[model samples]
Target: MENKNKYIILTTMLIQSTLLIVINCTIIDTSTLEALKSSMPIFNIMILITTVLMLLSLKKANSFIKKETELELVKSNMKNTEDLLNLLRTQRHDYLSHIQAIESLIILKEQEELEEYIKGISKEYRITNEMIRLGNSVLTAIINTKKEIAEKKGIVFHVRCKNKVSLHGINSWELSSIISNLIENAIEEASSIENEKWIKITISYVYNNFVFEIENTRKINNEIGDNIFKPGVSSKNAAGRGYGLFIVKNVVEKYNGSIEFKTTEKNSIIFKVILPSEDGAYGEKAI
Candidate 1:
């Protein structure tokens, strides 16, 4: 449809310009004919350039609109899905078991054991709440699940957000996708190391953008760090695998967002994404 419109506009311009020149030569006068003969080519050239630019602009607009539509559909599907609910249900069931164990510890009068259990549970609860602290329930579930996976694999996970973020007008699925893939990548990279493995996640709304950042403890090579967002590039040596950052970049661009890569002071790499929030930033809405 876009191409057809461009073609029609271009063709109409060419035909109209041609007939104008013909009309000038046949009916206007000799002076007008001479003027048309010299200026005609420039006119056509200008018209062609204008048409081409218009077509390019229209193409870009179409792509952006399509991406927005896809983002909306993804958000809708995500809202209707049961995966997050099921995940939380499982976590809740596990928490019940923890509660039972704590009760038994209390009844048995294991003072030292109960104290240690209380401390451990407090730390775990803090980490879990940090995941959803941003008030975006969808993003929270994703971060929570990933944190759980990281802990299960002996990877330390950290979330540095205290206030709930208002991630208004962002697609939940793509947002979840971005958060999940980055955290998973961080976990995978940190898991490859032997000691001091940790992944730190930060969510903030600053400078008119909702920021999502992931910094891990694994060292990154300059080569991988430089071309990290490119498709088919991965530090993990496996064929047909490196689409994580590629998809991440795709989603960020769809939302008119920006992503930055930096090598942290600890020689590890960090990915910082700044996405536009339609309602801008908000205050104190805990999830």
Candidate 2:
């Protein structure tokens, strides 16, 4: 919208200037301009050339803006890819220890302990498997990565999916920015307290809309609530602390989607995002 308004203002100014120049020429003394007829035509040609150049510049500016957006997506995808690789590497490294532990358990003939250890190990991968089942690599990477971060901070991160979701009009990077930012904020807020900390993420496709509901245990105060969506307004007092929701709000609006949240009776915050989907077969349900 800002860009559209800028183009409108620039075009209007160009048209106004051209009209004023033409009006001045029309009201000029005809005899006085007789000797400068050739120069007058050249001047008009210059104005036409200038107008064309201005329009072409505007077109280039628009093209540049588009390229910039694409570049940002590419950068985001690269970062997500890097994170996924790091996660894989960490898992691989842990597998060695897991194998060693299993071997030791087997050597000691501790069948019951071995079974429990294996169950616990398998439980750790359950969320990762579910994330992969989401059918979107970007979503899986962001969620799995953030889940690890949350768990490290002693936050119980849980995720639920009603079914496989289809992100019809949105790309991977856009999904990353939206989901990652929300989850990151949740992790930040949930990890701040000394009590029971938890984050719950729910995803579903309902009535042609892909829905994401992220609930985190936190009490929103008046100061944060008033300007939560504004840039630079963060609950944290650190430098460069805010702007997550601002970006999420912009990306959600870009795809004609809506994002909103409500505080639960238990003082938990649940952020819900609904984006239009290509397949419209699902029924509506509560998050």
Q: Which residue ranges in model 2 land beyond 4 Å of their true spot?
A: 1-33, 93-132, 238-241, 281-287
TM-score of each: 0.63, 0.75
Residues 157-223, candidate 2, lDDT per residue (tens digit)?
A: 8888786666756878888889988998999889987897999999987677889999999887767
**Where does model 1 exceed 4 Å of error?**
1-84, 91-131, 285-287
- Which one wins on TM-score? 2
The TM-score that candidate 1 achieves is 0.63
Model 1 lDDT-worst window of ten = 76-85
